[model samples]
Target: MAPSTRRAYATGERSFTCYCQSMNRSPWPASSDLVEDYVTHLFNTGIASSTLSVYLSAIARYHVMHNWPDPTQSARLKAILEGARRMNGVHQDQRLPITPDLLRQLHSRLHLTSNQHIDQRMFGAAFTLAHHFLLRVSEYTSISPARFNPDATLCLDDVHYDRTMLRCTIKQSKTDQRRNGVTLTMQRAESPFVHDVCTGYSEIRRLLYPANFPFFMHASGRFLTRSDVTEALKKCLPDSCDRMRYSSHSFRIGGATAAAADGQPVDAICKKGRWKSASFQRYIRPFPNT
Candidate 1:
């Protein structure tokens, strides 16, 4: 499991332990009734239905590890989850897509220069790459500067460019379960924007970083976090653009959307995005359904 998964599971365990202590009940081998009441307690505290399920999972994991039956399998507990979910509908924070036009606007506003520790060339390179390659921010950026994984995050060594093409080899992705990696090739784009920004960032990157360091390092000499990416994106939003409606994900969404609007084949879009199934269809939005 990813480190993030382990941390979430640990948090769930802590919540279960605290609730059991307050109720004067044993947390081990939780009875179905106790678990049901626990869900109710969380729901009453304004916990989302989705989070309620995570807490139940923590309780279930404890039982399984101690050679006990999974109390979460109880039909009554499942019914309670279903009822709560129906009562409190799922909330989706659907961010707006950053289409090609919006991307250009973002780039135009940035200050690109060679003297700064970080600047527009960095943002331009990241945005353009994500737009063309359909990358998840996590695949290219460090979640926290202190927690960067050299093997997983995009390092300078993973990229190569020639006069006409760029090739990026990702060591792993969220869906690459076997740890078998992938290499994506992008030809020289018809528009010069992509090539110029990427090569510019590359040149600056080599000057500041050794071959092993991350491609988008921060001015603080740390890896750029997702928060860093979001804040930069928000700052350069075209006037009147709602900052909340756009995020790091906008690049991927916009890339897929732009391709679709241009009449690119669904399969080609899927392949370019490295999507294994039609789930990529959900990535297309604000564009008409066909």
Candidate 2:
């Protein structure tokens, strides 16, 4: 199983165990009626239907792993969940993509100075690389100790420069369970100003770290964390309510949206983003009129 799947199952098991303990019920060999009651309890607590489904899956997986009958497989339990979904609705909030205009604004604000030169250059390169490559924050930065997979992480050696193009090899990812890696290449931006900024950042990165070092680093010499990247990107944007909607995911969403606006085919965008399924459509938002 993938590390992420294991983590989700662990979380779901914990939640179900707590629920069973509170009601003085046995989690193991739970009856369909008990599962229905648990589902109803979760629904009443206002958890989204999607989340409730995960919880149910976890319960089912737990039973299957132990060679026990899964109460979640009952038609009655499915009906309860279906009812909850219809009652609560299933819309999820979509994070706003950081468009090219927003990226330009961010790039312009990262001015290099004597005191903050290192930070400014690092942030600029990280931001530019993320946007151009359509990276998930976790793909580039260490997010949590428990979830970090060294095999999937990017190190300095993974990056190669060939003339004006930068090729980055991602050894593993959420989708790559077998550890077969993928290489994503981005050419120098056509705009001279953008090209210069990207080139400058690469130079700074090379000067500061050895070839084997983590590609993204903090000032203290540790790998950059997801929170660090999020906080830094947030500071680059203007202070506004919309800023709150932008996160590490905004880079991926923005890149897809920008590419679509530029007339790139969906298949090309999927190949660039390493999306295995049509789910990439979720990232392509309609470009707003300026």
Candidate 3:
């Protein structure tokens, strides 16, 4: 699983474990009825609907993994999900993506022009890849520095490439399925820029670590964590800025949004992103119509 996904699973597991412990019960050997009871208990205790939803979803997954039936199929489960309504005092607000101009400004703040620094090099690679390739942080992190040629160029072997055209073969995706492969033919203005950022990132890693090291690592020399990337983004941008949610996955969104704005075909964008289905359109939502 990707780091972000791992974090979510960890959080869910912690919540489930805590809830079970608080009830003076070991949930490890729980049955479907116990899961349903837990979901009901959450609602009766006035837990927030969204939070209860997360907890329930996690429990459901746990049950499914154990070959137990889902709570939703049970009468108690259905009631917990749909019968109870939110209190009038609570309002669920939908969040929106950051605007393009703000993103551009954020990008500028992250990549300084004259002086070069280690942190800058790290963020620059992350920001540039997200800006162009619509890459998930996982995709960037999955790439090993050793994969690059001696000149620091991506060998273009993972995907087929002509003199100016490239076809990316995504063997595995976030959804845990193999994509049918994608081809990208960069325009004159874009290819050089993408190549330079990728090369510089490889060089930075090579300078800091011995040959055959992971592409990105912490001061402790372990691979960089999702939190590391988030902290770097937060540090690079202004303290007061709140227009963007700015998770590592934002890079994937930024890529899709930029491609859509530039009039790339939706089919091409979908292939490059390795979205298993159109359901992913929900994640990108509507890009700047301009």
How well does each candidate superpose onto the true structure, as a TM-score? 0.69, 0.70, 0.54
Instruction: Kindly list the per-residue Cα lDDT of model 3 for residues 1-290, writing each as its tens digit.
Output: 35445466567668777878998888765666767777777777877766765666566656666776655456666665666654414432333333455455555676542144555666666566555666666654543322322222222233333344434333334543222334444543466656565556655566676654445543345454455566666665555565355566665666776677778887887766766467456456454321
Span of ten consecutive residues with least summed lDDT in model 2? 143-152
Q: Candidate 3, residue 105: CA error in Å?
A: 3.8
Per-residue lDDT for 1-290 in model 2, tens only?
34556687788889888999999998887889988898888888999877777777787777766778878878888788778868987675567887888887787776631136766776777777778778877677764522344565666778776557777888766555445788987676544444556566666677777766667665556667677678777777776537667788888898888888898988888887888778688788865432
Highest TM-score: which candidate?
2
**Candidates 1 and 2: which is better by TM-score?**
2
- What residue runs in model 2 are displaced by over 4 Å at the alpha carbon? 1-6, 12-47, 52-87, 111-115, 143-149, 189-196, 287-290
User: Listing every candidate in turn, what is its Cα RMSD in Å to the true structure after a full C-alpha superposition?
Assistant: 5.9, 5.5, 7.3
Model 1, span 236-268: residue lDDT tens: 887678777889988999898888888999888
Full-model lDDT, candidate 2 = 0.73
lDDT (C-alpha, whole model) for all candidates: 0.77, 0.73, 0.56
Model 1 misplaced regions, further than 4 Å: 1-93, 112-118, 287-290
